[model samples]
Target: MTACDQARELQRIIDQQLISTMFQPIVDCQKGTVLGYEVLSRGPSDSPLHGAPALFQAGEQCKQVISLEQACLLEAGQSCIRHGVSHLVFVNVSPGLLLPKAFAEDRLQSLLATNGLKPENVVIELSERYPADNPEALKARLTALKKRGFRIAIDDLGTGYSGLKLWSEIQPDFVKIDRHFIRDVDRDLVKKEFVRSVINLCERLGCRLIAEGVETVAELTLLRSMGIHLIQGFLLGRPNPFPTAELSALDNPDPIGGGQATSDAGYLGRYIVPLAPTASLGEAWQVLQSSPSIFALPVVDNDRPLGLLHKWRVMEVFSSTYGRALNETKPVSSLTAYDALVVEHDESLEAVSQSLLEDDLHYLKQHFIVTRNGHYIGLGSTRSLLRMMTRSRVEQARHANPLTQLPGNVLIQQEAVHRLQQNNPFTCIYFDIDHFKPFNDLLGYSKGDEVILSLARQLCTVFNGDSEWVGHIGGDDFVVFSDRLEIRKRCEEVQQLFALEAATRYPEAIRQAGFITGEDRDGLPRQFPLVALSAGIVVADSRAFGSAADLAATAAVAKSKAKKAVSGIQIVSNIAALNEMSDDHKTTLLA
Candidate 1:
């Protein structure tokens, strides 16, 4: 059939029994489980417009919009029982389809009971494709539905016209992100950042976002990295004519990929672990330990995700300046907003890719929240981003050294100075790499050069991709310009990545040479058979120190104090950021 003919033919069928149901799963990016399925429609077989959307659009053109919607809803309600699908059934209703007669004439709840369900279990998704001709009438009809315990949702957020306006008029319980927004989100930085902004906006407006149309493992991970809670995509599960036993499978490893599949492909599948709004810092810390990769967790009540917790920041309060106050803290979200990304299942992948792209540029803390019909379900992240974030900053500091090819004193010092200058800040930072007269003596200048080179490469990749600047001071020392706010975090990151890389990159000769020549901190053989580096962080940032040399001298005091601290990153960030913090804050608030 011609496109025109096919379109007409499809409408005729949706008005009849040809409206078949297709289920897509919503996935949780955090626990990687399925939460539920969203029901979409399929047109008659052999029709050129077999997809539900096209079929419904055809109905509208033919003035049988109500008939098409009726068929789809009937199928959804009946299928809910035929398939024994106990999860919420999401059926799309165009804005043009909600007639005033819906309240007094139609008994939707009674129609639903014929399929063995309640109004609350059936989520009526309202599509924004049709402009609201009379918004008040629409509101009155929806208010009646609300009285009947029906949950309303706004479909295709970000793609629709005036999504915020519709949201205000309808006050939907959930908002499904358009499929176009979630497609191939893994590689794109701009789209993800944009979606993240939407997530933040939702927080202000009190709406939940469910990301839709996830296909690849990478895309799923990308959404999670950005703190998106709920998701739905082909990678999660696909709709089946009948209920599949695989929806609840938790321990099953996907044959296609080693990761576990919590749900069959396309139906809502995501694992959710709940957190209270007033949870203590100790509790948050425990959760952090349990899931190291997760930088934030959704704070929820019953089924609603209320806010978020910053995993890294919470830990900082205890060990840093707020040590005594750490235990007194409750729910990290009290201080930090758990703004989450939300999208719906059954969306086009192209849209998803765009959102992920935007997120890459949004903030340093990257994570995406996924939702189904605006209900909290999962999260998304870019794998590459997580790897970069978790990488050791200390080893990176070592590698940052400009002279020896490791991150040296200069870069480390700058970070320290930046910390002192931070507004909430207190002091200075000291950057140190170990004095290496012996390694040069034992391994010859060439091997020493190789060591420096490896460290340098690691450092470059760490700072170059994520932050603005890092400098190198000569030999075994590095400086990082940082605000006092997250000083040790910067240090710890360097330490972890440095230790890991040092183990991996060092030559076999260094591993087994058995020369008994290096400095020993505890008199025990070091894992790589060498002493570890020491860093002293003094929190001071002052432009009065005209040259890098002066900064080096100031760092020297902190470094001496760190000799006792030993083999760890220390931050004296309290001193530095007075000027820098004001500059940064002014720039940030103004922008």
Candidate 2:
């Protein structure tokens, strides 16, 4: 169809109000409740201009966009009322329609009033499809809407060219991240960082962030962990013509960051306070004076942190002749140290400390900002970080095994107990040197110590990235535990690596014979095989074990069976299965 025909079609849809409104829920992930719905308008399904993009394009060409948008707003409000949706309704509005004079007297407000919808119940989602004709005019209109109790949201943030600048100017009450950023946030570190940074920025700016287009459980979980409570996506609930304002339940939801325990090496959430970016230097001075203990304050706009304001720096600025008069009235954000150290609340305290130390020494005096997602949670002093590190080192020393430096019995038990509560599938492999005591006596304790250290390093290297735990249960006994499916392959690799290392470490005569003559107890000389590995693996069943101790006992039984076998590898399904295996099969090992 020609542009003219498409224009006529758009006009008819607008005049007759034939647009279809689909209500997609915006959920509060943490609370597990539906916060509101985003009103998405569709043109007549039978028409060529059915999708939002096509219809808007047609309207754009025909100079009827304002009319089309107004019509959608009217219909969306009525549709919400008809559907009994009492929550906040978000409607997309083009940037072109944001002129101050036009919005001050626009029929959009009147249409909402007719449907019994107040400005507070409506959220004007400023679309980024078209650039603003006049930014100042748009800001003026948005400011007026805000004053009238209407909530403003900047839509498709991060994907748009002018989103940051627009955010800085208008400081919307909410910001919707574009689908591109949220598409695979769970798997993409870059996207995670981007979203995290956006979240922080939103917190500093005092703006609510809504993740758009969340399509997977991983994505939803990651967003929730990052402190993003408001989410909209197909994974939660798809947009429908008739939608209910009810949150769908998520299964087995993990805490933020997968319940990964925080090391004592990170900053806490005690020092964070909300300071406006537009606050005057005088206001900043008053804040610093009131809170004499804090070294810095995080400067923010709309709960999204911009940077930090150091008390010393501010005082230094004001100490200069005429400095107070020259800059007192200026926004505190203008003087904020944008490069001040900013770290997530979950970041390793050591990592944050190292970054500060490695950076220009000047930043040491500037207190670091601690944020959850991107919003300012508090300020962490360099002194506090150093203190935490000292305590962490002491704790590490207490938990680490002396021989191999791996975690000892206490920490190992703690790790096992934590996994038991999670109830995820996992395998635990318990292994020990086959003839460690005899070898230790024959080769002297020094050589035996080397072998134990070598095995520890091998275990750590093999299971390093699987989120698995390697622990020394003391003596020659060590365990490799993981929920990864490849644990079987890793166990084999460990056995093979130890075999090769053992062969290489022996003298020429011992290497050739694969055995050594050593004096056994009672002064009797005997032939003993070279050092070998014995591993017993248990694939846990949630139904079988009530405690970590029960699981450990079952794994010990499996280990004993593996030790008796000449080849030294035994895998059992569970504690019950370990008892059921025949004597011959239980002793059999992987080739």
Candidate 3:
């Protein structure tokens, strides 16, 4: 369409309120739940301005950007209400539209009220895409919005002009890292460092940081390891008119901290009745006085958790001569400890422990509230958390491999059994170093240990995802468990990486010669090829195998076949056919 036609179409879109809103979930990776949904506006599919860029560009050209944004905001609110979305709704707004003259505060409030939404439940996300001419004025306007109970977020952080300056001045409650920084973050060291700095800054500023546009599990895994809990991306979910509050992609059986079954904090929580936010201080004091064991009482409104009320704080007020009479009738919410750490029940114990260590010492002596999907569940004590941490550390040390510090055979067996019980299709890879004994004999045991550790590191780097696990079966033998279907390609990458890494450990001449002179088991001289990797891959497609031992036996057969292959990789897809092979045939195959 021509420029004039585009402007007319844009005007018609704004006038008729033809804009449609699609909601994309922003997930809390640690909790494996959706924290909120960001509202995305798009023009009608049949129009030339169907995409956001074309629609907004036309608005800017026609000088109807403010009107277009207003329509989008109203449509988003209506959609949210219609969909009965109770979680936070993040609506994008241009920086220019945040000005008092461009968008009136009363009108904004009226829009929220009309949709049956509260200011606290709606986040006004201002994109740094449009830099403000007068930041001080914008800051003043944002302050006014904050005072009115609206949360502010800066979108596309680090990509627009004056990102850090705007972040410092506004001090938004949330900041979303642009997609540029999130894409291939696992491979790019500079992007990783930049994100790490952003994470630290957000923590120090007491602001929530979200990593946007996570398209791959590698990026998701790396971001989660860096302490980024909130994430948004096409990998998790796509934008839709109606989106589910929970994402199955985030439901990782083995999360970043560890396995979810043992690492979740919900197991540590004890049931403690919560105090209503409307309860008076006098009533709260009575509750605390009656229950001397309760150190902190959760303040809950409906099913939602507001904050916590410490017994000590409440007692101090009541102890004073005039304090009781002056504040006894006030609501308990007035004394709510907003800063108390509130964690989701599914949050890993390791993550919760990190949060505690980062906070003041006072938290060490008190209790933290636990919630499930933002609803009050129970209270968890620091004493219990510390005790659990100690036990976990002891168990891990007992089961971990000494050389590489990876999981040992006992844990490896348990992991295999767990995957089998889950009955999900997965790949079990057994990795063996070819001619490792000869290499150790020629290059000493200490140098041999270096190769093992290097191989362990490579396995970790290549299989670093939520569903991937690497374990050491002792010596130069390691095993990998992964849910990815593309195990063959990943195995190829591992072989290529190990080949390069193994070459570095050999002498210059030995490397070029492609062989090392070493004594054979018969005490005779032989030519051993420089260390190479041999991988045995078994794709488990069903519950045909009863136990880990049975699977291990099949994997052993596969390994024997791999050792005799030229490519050093063998895959066994049919367990029944492999089992039917005679012992003599297997021996011949290995030979």
Candidate 4:
């Protein structure tokens, strides 16, 4: 058959949109909620008349393939709007197909706006298994898209020629974790570290990191432990033709943040409350009155969380030298739960409750702290565990997004200040979601959240609580304290891991891999330009500063250096760096 003759026949099917668009729901693996869907082009049945390959194979190569991609994007965009797609809608394309001048930005915008979508709501993915397309063309289009509120991603990285070239070429907002690194992530340190580096880079450069092909609970647990706040995998939800669940509605539609939200679909399980050891005798009494089973209230001041009045500890206090004044005595750590354990709020209630049950009988601590990141939310006691577990379910049903479960800012500041007062070594990691706002704007908050949660999970693993405490300071910013010695190394680890994860999770770079871009901030042509990351590492040590404010300022300075230095970790090891940057100008300018 003649090419044109065959093209006419293929065009009939392409025009019909017969190719059933397959969907893979992106989920917050840590929270077990659907966050978004990736649109995949599939064929109806097995016939050549219905297959994407068949249509393209029949003289539909360049023009037809490009047309088909546009069609799929338009369709997916419509689906997101009609279904209130809370999560991102990922649409895949190939560089070979997309780099053509035909893939115009203005035309695409018009099509999307027609479907109630903007450049911000879609994450354009590359379907190929290699790096980059025409360097100049991809950059030209992607930059234009970004300016218009669109975000770019590199899909299925680590499976092909995904390398530094691709990454430097197209600084994508989201990096899809190829199944290779995701499989057995819980068991593989290499994989864990690899993904962590990507997240680190994401945090530094304002990019979003996402893991693809996640299929196991262990993987989910590992990611959650690493501090990843979002995820996607079969363990959470499967994709459907339509958006089937509510995963958002929790994001601040307005500029402000934080509010009480709950859900009925899942239980919050029981969140633990930390009692101040020296809670004025009156406060302790009040807490006990509100909760009779509160055998102890955490005694917390500016230092670490301390214990409350243990049944036996209380008796011991009365029998001591000052037995008569025991009731009014200064709160002591004696009543505290030694080695108090913590579970993230996004975790499964069943597993956490079971753990509590197993340890309750022989428990040294009477409460469990329910936390998101590392900030405390509330206290979960043995008595309230049951009731609160049910209540948690209501919270989950009421609110769709599980990525954010912590109470909010007031608690975040308390946690930060508390760590500072402890005088222990801590690592302050000022995490910025490389291009998170743009990515979120492009893919939707749900998918953006998936990236956030994923990074949180990665950091938790790398920054696991030591004397080194890790906590979310809000938004994309996070901190970690490792008792002095390891604090510096830990910060470096976060930096490296972030870059690697960003490479893997974003497909735009992978598809744009071997290409090069020459552009300035103004979009004018330039020389060998590309996008990457900048991270600042500040170690919480005596030489650096004594207060949280000082530590934060030093850290912020170091972070600026990292961002400006291109690659490599910058540690504020001395007062000189801090000294050189004082407000009063005690130092002379180097002429």
Most TM-score-accurate candidate:
3
Q: Model 2: how large is the Cα RMSD against the reference? A: 14.4
* Tens-digit per-residue lDDT, 1-591, candidate 1: 565686558656754587778777765556655556787778766766677667766776767777776677777788778878777767777666676464342556665656468787877778765577777777788778877888888888877565678687767777888878787554333455567777887787786678877765445655665677677766567676664323332232211111111111112223336577767667777777887656777777666767666666676677778673745466555645555544443332233445667655755435554555566665554443233323334345444434554434433433433333323333344445453555665557776666556555555555453222445565555544433334566566766766665544445666566333554566654333443456666544444444333445545545655755755555443334224344554344223
Provide the RMSD of all predictions against the true structure, rounded to 1 decimal.
Answer: 22.0, 14.4, 19.1, 27.2
Report residue 206 deviation for candidate 3 (angstroms).
51
Q: List the candidate 3 regions with Cα displacement exceeding 4 Å.
A: 1-261, 325-329, 357-365, 417-427, 507-509, 517-526, 538-546, 571-591
Q: Write the per-residue lDDT of candidate 3 for residues 281-357, one digit (tens) a residue.
A: 99988888887878888888887878888988988888888999999999998899988788887686878898888
Residue-wise C-alpha lDDT for candidate 2, range 423-462, written one tens digit per residue: 7778888988886766777677888888888999999998
**TM-scores for every candidate against the unseen true structure:** 0.43, 0.48, 0.49, 0.39
Q: What TM-score does model 1 achieve against the real structure?
A: 0.43
Number of the top-ranking candidate, with lDDT as the measure: 3
Q: Tell how far residue 356 is off in model 3, in angstroms.
A: 3.5
Evaluate model 3: give its TM-score. 0.49
lDDT of all predictions: 0.58, 0.77, 0.82, 0.56
* lDDT at position 515, candidate 2: 86
Q: Which stretches of candidate 2 lie over 4 Å from their true place?
A: 1-267, 357-366, 417-428, 464-469, 481-484, 504-528, 538-551, 564-567, 571-591
Model 1, stretches more than 4 Å misplaced? 2-16, 102-106, 243-389, 392-591
Question: How much lDDT does candidate 2 score?
Answer: 0.77
